[model samples]
Target: MTGEVLWAPSAEGRQPHDRVVLVLDRGELRYRDQRKLQGIWVARGDDVGRIQGRQGPDALDIGAAELRDLLCRRRGELKPALMDQALVAGLGNLLVDEILWQARIDPRRAAASLTDAEHARLHRGLRRVLSVSVREGCVPQRPGWLTSVRARDDAACPRCGRSLERRQTGGRSSYACPHCQRPP
Candidate 1:
């Protein structure tokens, strides 16, 4: 229940300046960057109860069943819905992209439109991608991995060697293998 708070100031025009405070309990993370006043809530501790962020309901001390029920009610885009920390916690853009690719689901797919099979795929993919990424501390780039091209403007698909396409999605650069993730 006792932990230390870490603070970092934002640079000019950086808004809240990448400040994250970790609340630790018994040497495990209980809360992370609880900057609700500044509209930032990174993650919550597994043992913590009822977490509140600046955006409200950022994460409640709820069980897995509650979290599943909440996810089922979202009708928004699948990526953003998964990224909503208030709903699932501990997922971001890189994770989302990697999950979708592993699940073979398009990023633009509507959450409600996904079939049960696709949902299963998404869940499995999310877990797998996150588990490995967390161990490695963020997605590491392999020579031919898609992530290698993620930040390269003219990078091509590693699988097919075709030019990768980029678009502004959810206010971030979205890199996709056009051939592999064709529109439905």
Candidate 2:
């Protein structure tokens, strides 16, 4: 076969018995004691599957409509709204911090308080940050990127360097440039 052989215990063995079941091209082998298949070669092929884009953490596929709906009705804090897996999928704590920083929205701001312009900015920020993160795997901390602050507990804001403040939001420690993102 062109695919690898993945093995599972036979029904009898799974229940409680010494009988062994083996599957081979010749046919099924049933032995009261044990059965072993010889010359059973599994092949690895290059055409296994096609590459797909990164799906969010919950593995729920999200489209534009669902994203808009989730954002519109979300009544929690902005950080929590972004962190909800069912709402957008694939969003993690780092992504939320980066998105809020990029959009200049305070983590504590209410989701309903976001203006149309701010919402647009947030949408753009999410796409931009997630795309880059998925491409490189995790948030990339380039020299100018804000993710540098995430690495250091005492790391100051890259933009203001006024001692980044860490706060708990949605059960996660959120780091923000106090000067850049003010509480709304």
Candidate 3:
């Protein structure tokens, strides 16, 4: 809430049936996201509790064994598995791609198929990615990194300097380096 919003509408957006859910704690915060087809309903105390209950441990605290267990719980590709908050929280699409790329693991590989070495690399990558994200705030403090190229139209692998591959994974545009993160 302290940082300025880089991108947002000039004013609040609303349409028919759009109503402010609540000024949380009376004039604390309001539901201000742009409304489209479905109205965005703000969460109350109970709703917040339920949602947080579904969230797993933060990326920083999860041990290698715990991470391995979470990965094994899903038979799906690594991208989707990483995106699951119920497994381990705080991983988004960008973070997942960055983590896999940093760990030198293929995004399409099955989560259950990861070897012990791969898991170790993944754990390190997760910590590094989360640390960098928290520190730099997604502003790309330096060049030649995953987040730096992931959003570019002519993105290439920062480490290998090879053309990056982009494809659909779990309904999101997943990025990977063909040279660094070889496909299975």
Candidate 4:
């Protein structure tokens, strides 16, 4: 969440925040992290599998059935379960909140409490959100999207027009529309 990879026309264009810069034949690829939260680890062959074995299936690649099964196996609230990289990789607080909001699921609901249709909705939301985010190159703040107004003091649900609610879920801020995401 705190790291960025930027490309520059030349190595001389490196910024103060750039932690590493690869001088390519035509340009430079720079890794920048203001918080230094991400790191690089090199592994060879089987070692790579061993290193990544603890992480669950990637959010972008996991199938709907697999996601339902994974959630069903979790014993915690939905938000934390989704944020746990050991349970579902590639999802952070912001993405999980947005996904739940999109799925119209309550963040406080038990992880295993989703109905079959709810699971389907959740999976679809994940795919759609990630696809748009990947295309935009970031979690875009656009109209009709939760991210657009989530941080505003007077934010309202883009869909329902009801005031948005904010709370601390699993130690991270969560934004949801109370009218859309009713408590379980």
Candidate of highest TM-score: 4
- Model 2, 137-161: lDDT tens digits are 6688876567866778678777776
Q: How close to the true structure is residue 126 of candidate 1, measured as C-alpha lDDT?
A: 66
Model 2's C-alpha root-mean-square deviation from the true structure amounts to: 13.0
The per-residue C-alpha lDDT of model 1 at residue 70 equals 65
lDDT string for model 1 (1-184, tens) is 1113433332223234224433344332222332333344346685234334322232223343444466678887777877777667666667777677767777777766776667677677666666666677667676666777788768888778888777787477766677766545
Show model 1 residue runs off by greater than 4 Å.
1-48, 52-72
1-184 per-residue lDDT for model 4 (tens digits): 4478888887676778888888899999998876554566679888998878879998889999999999999997998899888998889877887888999999889999999889999999999998888787777887898989998899999989999999874456789998999964
Model 4 TM-score (2 dp): 0.84
Every model's TM-score: 0.63, 0.61, 0.73, 0.84
Off by over 4 Å in 4: 7-29, 169-171
Q: What are the runs in model 2 whose C-alpha is more than 4 Å off?
A: 1-68, 169-171
Name the Cα RMSD for model 1.
7.9
lDDT of 3 by residue, 1-184 (tens): 0122222233344333333433333333233333222334458878977767777887768999999998887888888888878778877777787889889999889989888889999999888888877786663425766778877899888898888998974456888888888754
Candidate number with greatest lDDT: 4
